[model samples]
Target: MSSFAKPGSEEQELKWAWIWFKQFCAFHRRAVEREREFSADEVIAFLRSKRDANVPAWKRMKVIEGLIVFRESVQHRNPADLLPLRETMRGIVSIERAKSEGYDTIDDVVGKIDPKEPDAIQEFRRALRRGGMALRTERTYVGKLKNFMADRGLTCLADFERIGAADVEAHLTDLAVDGNVAPSTQNVSFHSLLKFFTLVLKREMGKIEAIRATKKPMTPTVLGPKEIAGVFEGLSGVHLTIAKL
Candidate 1:
């Protein structure tokens, strides 16, 4: 058999195994007993537990590989039989590929784009439509809300509760000052979010003193008394009386 030990090197893999041994003990709530030796069954159980906890697939696989090394090199036990079942190994590889392609988690695939799937923004859109809101208005409101959630990683309805006026003010203020969006666009996002909170969610966010988008001052077009009288020159009978009135 080929040499299993690295030449001129201390058994580092065995040391790593010792580290994981303590962790595994703690995980199972077992007391640290020096005479205890881990079994393949415990390793499989640990991996199953990690899977249920949503531990990243890649990280869990590393734990398995580490245990295999620990069993073979330290305990002088053949761990080939202890390797993950073929189906489970395939599943981990699939998850890794999916993650690399940007589908890192279930939430990413389900709740990101499709807002009609019983998620936070989806529920808001449903309520808006039921209230007879225009289709375009619903899209605009939900689109901005999705952008808000995407920026902050707020993936669900529960995340909305953590939001306060200050958070909203900061987001809107960024749009006006940093994003440099037109005053009208800023106003639309601002009012849309306000309506979402008050009407759809039935949560009141009192008056917000957000940074107001700059608007050109309107100079009133006042007509002088002489200019007004000139307007009556073309009137007749009742029309003239009504104009005078």
Candidate 2:
């Protein structure tokens, strides 16, 4: 029934975090009505929802830090579990600051991408530009995220809040078992999803315990007779003598 966080300083922005959390609960959830208590999953979902809504990373960091402080001083729970989230938030802030690093942003992202894309996708591209990642990598990440959304019937990024580690595992497992994708392909999809969740969604993915893709057999790398002959064809004089020796 109680809906108030303890008084906190403006310097830390803990006050604003409480305000945001309450508003988030009222709008998206009934946690406030239930107990004003939220689990790590809910918090992750909330932060991701904020990212989906185009909320700045600094504000999300404030919520995370404030929640940690609240746990320590208010609920007296261990805040160790949230430390990784803090690190992730720091990376987000760093990425936002990286726009001025002088890598090509005018065309690499702002011009090449459709302006009609979702804000989350647009932000994902901006993050890639600031990170200086290859264009191939950006496309791969976006494609993988789209596949996940398709599988889940997710129409917009805002619904990404419902996705978590379980969904990630399920999708990868289906790709391996049902779709029968190659091991390397599934592996790329796995990394692509992980990076998207961590960097774009602003959430930490838990350990994946899904069935793995089968590895394909490979031929040995020893030089063939033709290749050996070709190599000797280019050698001459002292080099040929040394090769013969």
Candidate 3:
């Protein structure tokens, strides 16, 4: 257990710091006897993996900071590089918070995007761009792919290997049945999975057979002349102008 000599709430921070430090060291297979040293790659992998876990974003951010604190205070290592990574994580958390608050500026959305996205997903995105896919299509495919991965607890490229055709089929089925997705959305999801498996992962998944969503064709409600006149009967000002259109 890690303890701070200082009193008050700082103790809790120190405890979490110790926990993160210990977990980091253990995950890397560094024995207690060895002076624990971490590289940038290790730092990034740890953070990315944790983001996919059930851990809350706030706590994950704290864990990053805690590790930095432990390294500087306890290990006495110069963690200058780690500082930026921590700040990057902070930016992600802030962006997510802003999104939840309904701030959807292009800058905000771009800032929230992970620069170091998983290799498979990033490659798929690149492929989409290279093929001149529409911006909406790219976003849809990437979003669906992410949703599929998140559903299976996959957080990184290594985890993609565990995915197979059956997994893809099952995911599509779930989207149609449980997710209540439309046929178009289900089709997009399927194409996204196929591209990910074929182009990015370079895996040979046979033809995927999954339950598809039925397209709910929207029946447009056309108002008769009387109904339209009634709708605008008592309208005036901007409302009347809009109704006239």
Candidate 4:
């Protein structure tokens, strides 16, 4: 008989078992490493020691049977292949560790934010629209109000109420001097602020006059030949012919 086929050779069986155990460890190490935290050498050594002692022959056979079952469960299985039970346990332990450490579930750190007072700008604009202001006029007023808040770093309407006409005048002057805005543009921005403070904030902007008004230059009107011909000729072709008849 060949050396491997010899029965009752305890040393040879132990050596064969160790070889199978090493192969199992290699496969289990790869599986454990996929989990990002498990140390393969430590896990393999620990499991191998446990399997060699205290585990009964029937249980060991069942574990080996499970390995065969697992291998057969895949698309391909080799009858000659042998696998150790500890590898499967290592995979299960890795999974359990990951779950225990809270890596498995989605974190709750980003809770829902409350929609409250910070939404005042939107509310104010809606109120203005409901109050029958034209779309363009409402847009202009809201835009200026936003600019005022941005310029002063104001957070709320209450914060804006503390500002006086002097602040408004200063803002307009800054737009004219530093921004180099035209007098008409400055006047538009000024009026937009005045209207928002008076209507939306319910603040009295008493005697707040516009800085300047630019009268657009009038240009003479001209007519094209087609327009002039259409005006002079009136109806044409079949209509004209029918009318004459």
lDDT of 4 at 230: 72
Error of 4 at 41 (Å): 88
**Each prediction's TM-score against the native?**
0.40, 0.45, 0.45, 0.36
* Tens digit of per-residue lDDT, candidate 4, span 194-230: 6667666786765544344344546898888877667
Residue range 86-180, candidate 1, lDDT tens digits: 34765665556446655655334323346445378777766664564655676788888887777667888888888878777878888878777
Pairs clashing within candidate 2: none
Please report the candidate that would top lDDT against the real structure: 3
Which residue pairs in model 3 clash with each other? none
Each prediction's total of clashing residue pairs, residues at least 3 apart in sequence or on different chains, is 0, 0, 0, 0
User: Per-residue CA lDDT of candidate 2, range 28-107, in tens?
Assistant: 64665423556777678888988899988888888788777666655566878878898989877655644544334445
TM-score, candidate 4, is 0.36
Candidate lDDT values, in order: 0.71, 0.75, 0.76, 0.55
Query: Which regions in candidate 2 have their CA more than 4 angstroms from the true location?
Result: 1-105, 109-112, 215-245
Cα lDDT over the full model 2? 0.75
lDDT of 3 by residue, 58-144 (tens): 777887898887777777888897888878777677566545545474243333345688765777767765564555767788998
